[model samples]
Target: MSARRRSISFALFGAALGFATIATGPAKGFDFNIFVDPEDNYIDASAFLARGGFIPVPVIITEPAVDGGFGIIGQFVRTPEHPGDQPPRTMIGIAKTGNGSTAGGILRSGNMRDGSVRYKYGFGAADMTMPIFPFGLDQSVDYHNKNLAGFANMRMRLGESDFWTGPRLIYRQTDVSLGEDADLGPVASRVRDQINNLFDSKQYIALGASLHYDTRNNPLSPTDGINGVLRLDFYDDAFGSDADFRVGQGALASFTPFGEDWSLGILSKYKWTNGDNPFFTLPSVDLRGVQSGRYSGDAAYSTEVELRRQFTPRWAGVVFGGYGESFVSHTKLYDAEGDIWAYGAGVRYKLARKIGLDVGLDLAKGPEESIFYIQFGHAWGRDMD
Candidate 1:
């Protein structure tokens, strides 16, 4: 389906959940929240979950944002198969970021940490940046792109093995357009002359496999344990792709506790993409402080750390900082690099103690600007492990 159609589909799907539970009370296994003008100027009606357990959640938001608008989201977690069954855990969700991003997904896991399966369908704008010619010219063309994708994945725990391996397939269509403020005279002609297939929009497919491991007790807000992943995927003309390419991705996260109420957390990611791939698919830099994606080269790495101390029954304090580097090509990492750094601190409130969920906010400074995030969970993505 077209990217726009998929986005609308996910939005409608999430709304169905909202309609069913709107008149239902909290006793009916539903949780909802409303936040007005939270940073991005949107009235957010949401159903979110933390470590709090299985409950249906729905979220609606009115965003008075720049290049962003209204949206809805729905999410929940439950036991695999049925609520009465035991062991394996599962989560299903659909959401629209209001910045024109939308998606729906389901993930299942083995209680014994033996395996997992994930399926997703999505559409809308991708937070991507480019450093290549024609597409990356700051003075020439500010870029905007929308992507539609469907993905399926499965992983099995190797018998008595600590590692998990799985196969995955991805299909996507992307459309790139020039920003309104673009200037054509200065460098547009040169871009046109140098580029051959960078601007074309088309459908593509990728098939590959992944290996991962995680130990964090609660990856969302890890108080202890570790999380790591290694994955490689390939796409070629044989798969109806406009380009032929391969990508490798990896991440590692660890959390440790000290004393009674203190803990340390660290997260990191690295990516290497090459071949006839689209610019937006390249590795880029994103963390705190950096709002727009700016660095998309052949390789990139980013890392962040946080220190936390629970000071009260329902509150906690934290401080954090991180930096990133992007290389023009997939080198050994340290050799070809452009650095971007950011750091900040924030506080948290235990919104739902049963789930170990804390809702909070943060203000941080990046190399070029500063930003604030109304955090729902950890600012980064980590495996459930």
Candidate 2:
């Protein structure tokens, strides 16, 4: 399946697994005031969670890339033992999309060893159907994918600093086959042969490391500060992988607050790969309106900016735009024909004031399509760790 399908499926599976392990009941005499921020009187979940409440947040996945879907995620957060320590959290849920895709899994994140170390890990399985446009051709072919994947990462904070570094491991096994009813008619034999060769079963194992620096006011959401990461992965036969390749990725995001009611957020990312690797593993231009894997190559880069205005104590509005490109060679990056752009607007609600968490919706338009996303936290906040 395509990259977007895999992402959607894994997200659903992980959430379902996590939710399955959690058991909670309505609190007796649950105080409604806990849902409101004390300082600003805005609706929020900070107090309720701080008071040991478990929240079952509905997951509304509307990205056109995955054909849209819905699910529920149950989140349980534990207060930190110390003032500056990281709070531990568990999340679980499941989801299915209109395209007959489904998944579930569990995730845990927290600090250890007196806040010196942080860890996140999860496992999930998914079955999905996705459309693949081969070799940038307008014609699309359907493919079915079944996969199980897992990953774990551990980072140690540099003593008294904002930097952290860590090792990471990932494993995945996948089976891919052409959709049973797909019709590839009137196509050239060479192109047909290429498509026929794309199906297979594969196992991948990668070992990687990451360097990170963060000074954001809040990890879940941010009004100001900078966060950045650089990571490298090596997938090799020595690691029990079917292919030998190296991948590198880097990303940076910064938020700047202007006065009390305005803020600006900017994000940039770059990824590249070398050596023999599957086409689906190539770097792609990731943007709001573009489907993942629709514009993929050996290297890719993208940047986006958002300007936000706080309309009220509980509501905010934002406008954003981005540009990206994917190219077969780094030397041709500036002149790549795959260059694309997207722009959009959205509104946000302060769902957890104390933690700076926000929920919102956005509608974006790209070169080919318009898409909407039901976003939790920052839209550019994925894989920040």
The number of the candidate with the highest lDDT is 2
Scored by CA lDDT, what does every candidate get?
0.55, 0.73
Candidate 1 lDDT over 61-126, as tens digits, reads 222122223333434443233221122335565555444454454544443332233333333334
Q: What TM-score, computed on C-alpha atoms, does each candidate reach? A: 0.69, 0.85
Among the numbered candidates, top TM-score falls to 2
Stretches > 4 Å off in candidate 2? 1-31, 38-41, 79-86, 185-199, 330-336
| Residue 11 displacement in candidate 1 (angstroms) | 17
Q: Clashes in candidate 1: how many?
A: 8
In candidate 2, clashing pairs total 12
> Candidate 2 residues 208-232, lDDT tens each?
9999998887776577899999999
